[model samples]
Target: MTKPVGMEVAVAAAEAVALCNIDVAACYPITPNTHIAEHLADIIADGRIDAEYITVESEHSALSAVMGASGTGARTFTATSSQGLMYMHEILPITPAMRLPVVMGLGNRAVSGPINIWNDHSDIIMQRDSGWLSIFADNGQEAVDMFIQAFKIAEHPDVLLPINVNMDGFQLTHVVEPIVFPTQAQVNKFLPPYKPFASLHPDHPLSMGTLGLPEIYTEAVKARDVATVNAKKVIVQIWQEWEKQFGRKYEPVMTYKTAGAEILILTMGSMGETAEVAVDALRKKGVKVGLLKLKLWRPFPFDEIRKAVRGAKTLVVTDRALSYGGPGGPVCSEIRAALYDQPNRPEIVNYIIGLGGRDVRVEDFMKMIEGAPKAKKSGDAYQIYGVRE
Candidate 1:
């Protein structure tokens, strides 16, 4: 059994990638995300992992290189942050359309305008419609475990799609934590060598990512959508297998102290951990408050969310990214749509918080929970927490 070791989450994620024995990693350095690629490069340089580390010029080139490599049946990996992710936007949809299972470690960061280098969901939320399976980690251990599981889910025969394992920029990436690194043998058992369902080889030449003419463009898009929605089954199956092998269970929607609760707060990423503390404190004070942490983002877990929010009188949905001129935050909008038709659906209140790595303490979560009822009564779509006039 491998013992827990003190390691930075970024390095631990690199180690996890190494354990998977990927064929190639196309990387470009960006803040917070740089450490992951740097460590992976060091591992490759030291001959610890026999993988090709391609130092690309930009995030666009990095993803493009991985797409080309993955097309040739290579188990490809990559990492990027806010603006870097934006650079790869052009090729993002193409990778999934071609059914390439390239796994990416997205160091979640704020998008640039004011040029902030901090943690937020803005980067990942922007790519929500990119047709990739996206999952979030609340801590370092989850980050490591999710990286290992990502490849398996992406490379599954029934689900040949790319995936993004998102970890908060500085919050989770730069922090040191005691993480249990699974032995290479254990990882090998959990995630076997990736076997591509199709490959671009001269021996048996086939076309991929070709122009979808007006004749079949809609059909082609529909097919990709079907494949993405269908991937949830394979994703769950892989997660269950990982749990059986490693004893760490993962679910789409995770609940805390939710039994008999009248009000619940919903969150994603690392903020869930802070919300749990608030839930415990409120529970001790005879308040009926629970917490829901969403792990799976793409192919959103509609059923699981409805079940979790059932019987609750109110749900305070927190968003780390804003929707700008839209209804509210992207997350709040999705939750509202998910619970719209359900009978006896709880009142969903939206609170935008923790953008650009702003500190969201336990008191903040407590305040949200305590103030949810009034917020719902006010009839406002959403409120940005801690915003100054």
Candidate 2:
């Protein structure tokens, strides 16, 4: 017997935290991301859940606190965005290297330069090599579901890595849409209290987070790298389990109506929704085009991407962040790299779209398709979309 549920990212977020029954929540407020933390606090205050709510002074401290708390064998949670995420960059490495399965919600926002508060992938992209299992959500429902999935995958003994569930700042964070929030009993049955395999203790505490010799340092780093690289398979497995229990399906990379398409468009995070509009319009006009939405970014599904993009005539990758001198876009570079080794790989084009929360109309995407033919003639890896001199 399923009960009725509503949207509101804040409420959905609160329900996720409550369902996980997190033992520790160390946080500092930031726009868009603040509501998630606020709602969790309210839920805790009302005696809805018994969890340690640590009001930290800064994002760095917030992550550091979670690093320590999760080290002590407690399931932990936190939320942040943009500058807040940037502030915790230093501690991001520490959380994963120490093998804490802390789940965080990154309400994706544009990193500031001239002072802006819109959404972008810069913040998460900056932490690209930070060794965390990064997952991007296309909507509010994935945002809620991925967090629950993060805990299970991250805490797994085979993949002890921190995970970030990324959602667009104002877009998904503020927008209201119906999301199926799991009951406490279901959540309990799904994700139990995190029992850490390794920890800092006195009786068995040999030495935690100690500096390793140069000979051992590289191996230690590779272990984490291999774990992240292998995480794609684990991610798919976990999603299947999640679907089995909850009756909702998700894949590390989702292909929309691409079974027999000639050209495929790739997108990540929130832009995938906007791309869906373009896909529909193109399909209506008898264009053999489709979409590929990338959900797992950190432990990138390279093999999956290569297989998916095969047989397509042209592949257009729409990125939200620029890589500068590489393909001019982060997602484009990764996709290109993934297909570079394939003999039958399609001609790929990269387009940077929707920066600083810009409105991405379906026509803009149509323009990208119009420009794709010339991209091969020009022989450049990418072209900035919707940019004017």
- Work out the TM-score per prediction: 0.99, 0.97
Off by over 4 Å in 2: 1-4
**Residue clash pairs of candidate 1:** none
Q: List model 1 lDDT by residue over 1-389, tens digit each.
A: 67899999999999999999998999999997999999999999999988899988999999999999999999999999999999999999888999999999989999997899999999999999999999999999999999999999999888899999999999999999999999877888888888888889999999887888899999988998998999888888888898888898899999999999999899999989999999999999999999999999998999889999999999999999998899999998989999999989998889999999999999999998888888888899999988897
Clashing pairs in 2: none
lDDT tens per residue, model 2, 227-308: 8888778889989989999988888789988978899989998888878888889899999899999998988888889888
Least accurate 10 contiguous residues by lDDT in model 2: 1-10
Question: Local distance difference test, per candidate?
Answer: 0.93, 0.85
Name the best candidate (by lDDT): 1
